[model samples]
Target: TDFEKEIKGDMLSSFISEVRELVLDNCKSNDGKIEGLTAEFVNLEFLSLINVGLISVSNLPKLPKLKKLELSDNRICGGLDMLAEKLPNLTHLNLSGNKLKDISTLEPLKKLECLKSLDLFNCEVTNLNDYRESVFKLLPQLTYLDGYDREDREAPDSDAEVDGVDEEEEDEGE
Candidate 1:
């Protein structure tokens, strides 16, 4: 489809099975569990559940095609190992603003061999000594941490110019 399918700020129960992208940020769950998700979403590629009050991700349904998942601003303390199986193809994961406290808590993520980018902004683990070095050592497969690499190079912005397409040049041509 030409248009991206996105469901933002909506109740989980109202989500469509065929949607490829879903954003349910700020939708709270009573038991801190992901409800209303099923294995029926075979086509889903991206999912964002920021600020959803989730304390654990044990309830997530299998999403084999999922490549990017955003679970930032939640209350999650751990139980991330399940994501390796549930979202097997996940390449990017954002767990910023959560309750993660130690680098040991992220050891389970090593199973996610495809994960290239991981963001842990505002998490307690970031305050640990040698945080960046520890994480890079633990998850050697990771290419970017908190948007930067072990070499301290920042990841390119998604909106940055590509293939020399400049707005000023386009306007001048007009």
Candidate 2:
């Protein structure tokens, strides 16, 4: 199909004029890579490249307004640093079901202050020790991790701590 061939080639740059959101899922991209494609969408805010078999995220043009990106179920091994550097306004990212193994690969994300939500649900990195705590410490601005909110965890802890400490200790004093 021309559409498939166009998407697989650098021809995308010619079509995208003012596209804000683009979804190119399951394209079975050649070489499992996406290069020189993103540069076309100048006004792109959201991009979903799910299940595209992408192995790298290089040659991506800086998208200042990009807020959300979905690269789930791809072969992406690394390049979070590039993502963090290029998309400063990115707030949500889904890298689930990938080949990512080391949590340190996410260290670059600390610089992304606007990033609030990250989903690494089925990635191998999720098996690391203290994954949640480590991620929270690295990116404190993140209110959500793997779908769980910081407020949700803190709220229950505060309630349990107050009840256990004040009520239990006061009762024991009497």
Q: What is the lDDT of residue 128 in candidate 2?
A: 94
List, residue by residue over 101-130, the lDDT tens digit for candidate 2.
Answer: 987888888888888788898999899998
Q: Pick the candidate with the highest TM-score.
A: 1
TM-score of 1: 0.80
TM-scores for candidates 1 onward, in order: 0.80, 0.73
In order, candidate lDDTs are 0.84, 0.76
lDDT of 1 at 39: 81
Q: After best superposition, candidate 1 residue 10: deviation in angstroms?
A: 22
**Per-structure clash totals for the candidates:** 0, 0
Highest lDDT model number: 1
Task: Output candidate 2 Cα RMSD.
Answer: 9.9
